[model samples]
Target: MQQKPLTGRLILADVARGLALLTMAIYHFSWDLSWFGVVDWDVSGSPGWRLFAQLIAGSFLFLVGFSLVLAHKSGIRWESFWRREIKVAVAALAVSVATYFIFQDQWVRFGILHSIVVSSLLALPFLRVHYVFALLCGAGVILLYHWLGDYVLPYRQFFWLGLNSLPEVSVDYVPLIPWFGPVLLGIGCGDILHRYDLLRLLRGSASPSVISRCFAWFGRHSLATYLLHQPILFGVVWAGVTAGVLSTNAGDVQVRSFQQSCVMACSQTVDAGVCEQACRCTSSEMMNRGVWEDLLTRPNDADVREIAQQVFQVCLRR
Candidate 1:
């Protein structure tokens, strides 16, 4: 038999979300530092950093699924659901628009919020299904993507399906296939919690520490924190750069890093000699034209982007 809907908010979930938010902030700070050349390592490309990012994304998606069950286990609250969905959808659109203007080359078209909007809708039917069935479906989705994720569909619009051979240039690209698996798994877990009345016990438990309480607060306002934290962190780093507290050699470091990454990426499709020559050509040209620093700091600036594109074309012909 099905159990009644669990009453009240789950404190543990909020604390978990708060902790996730904290870790996310830490990761973003590292990314910001790297972007400003304060760090030598590439936070976006490092294996450890990539793994951390994936785990954080998975936790948030899982919570999305779990929260769905918590809110609608008794019955679908259509009004509340629509209200929240519209808000999330709007926020996702705003992110896409904002990133497009800021990072024209690698904007976020389908990031975490976008994924949540789609995955939440897809996960709705699973809420009424058996927990074991939901788990099975989740495993199947993950396995399917693992086995066939490399096959490319021949369209740019299909990139968000996770089945296309698109460049991994987007700031955030959370596709529906494997990512949706986490949501299904979260739903299964939530179902089990309700079945055993575990949520009620968790809700009654007191937060043991002030830190935990703080995390809970952040968790309760996770969306706002997610949206606002990056701009604030970026501003802080930008201010440090303006004040001359950060490294002045950032341009040199950035150029070197770009050459290394470009060669690595180019080598995958061409000979080492060709990759090295092209990257060196592009790097030298940008440096010669005095656009390297501007390109890094103001990637979206029209004049910088135009000059950068011309440099790339010139290098490609060499």
Candidate 2:
């Protein structure tokens, strides 16, 4: 029996974030459907869907910037800042661990939460400076990504920086370079909003509609919702598959799934170059020897297992 007027902590910013969350849930649901073979096209891979995802990621990062400024513009709130930072960092670690089990190879190495936490830490220096400086710095970083994209990195370890080209195997990779631009821009926008009293004006005039209230509620509890939504969606899809309500061809699904998972998992232990080659070689060799079915059906078969291992070893050497 918890009841409080929604208007008490309500703000336009919360509703805006809520809307972003709603869209994000929808995007993930669609992606989950594709993963389950409910759809023919890969929602996460399609150009339109990819663009949609970028927009969602951008919006979330922008809000991260905006929220950072809103909380600390008066002066740095060291206590509150660290408290929030710890929560975000912990949630990010949780995501990495969970995804490691669920998606192993393609687990979220440095996904959105990881990026946000790092970006927030990096943005601390700019908080006390002029907004224009942050805006320009952000713009410069974005351009730097484009400029650096043309050069080959001498070392592969720094791929997480997002300045180098790497195999597109990560399930959710949001490198720091271009992505941090939005956050910096958001900080600048926050300054503009505060200086003009925009946030106060928006909050003062907000209508207490049910939709608005619900959105605000979701926005307020965004972190918890973000953590839970994916697992729930995944469970629902798994249930459907178990109930035979949704049918997927085992071979196509399993092969693609295994290859993708293998590359993603392998990438963690090896460079992207080696992982990609090994996975491609392994999957191809399995398919070529007409032993893919045997491997899938009898994973413990000594002969097939030996052949798979040999392929991996050869791939690594090459």
Identify the leading candidate in terms of TM-score: 1
Model-by-model lDDT, in order? 0.82, 0.79
Please report the candidate that would top lDDT against the real structure: 1
lDDT of 1 by residue, 1-318 (tens): 667666667788899899989899999998888877887765765679989999999999989999998889889999999998998998899999999998675689889999999999989999899999998998888898988846556455876667765444567889987899989999999999988877786674564578877888899998888999999999998899889888646564677567666765765455444565787788889888887878788978998878876886678678
RMSD of each: 5.9, 6.2
Local error of candidate 2 at residue 73 (angstroms): 0.6
Q: State the lDDT at 233 in candidate 1.
A: 95
Off by over 4 Å in 1: 256-318
Which ten-residue region of model 1 has the weakest summed lDDT? 267-276
Colliding pairs, model 2? 105-264, 105-265
Q: Report the alpha-carbon TM-score of model 2 versus the true structure.
A: 0.79
The regions of model 2 sitting more than 4 angstroms off are 1-10, 150-152, 204-206, 258-318
TM-score for all models, in order of appearance: 0.81, 0.79
Global lDDT of model 1: 0.82
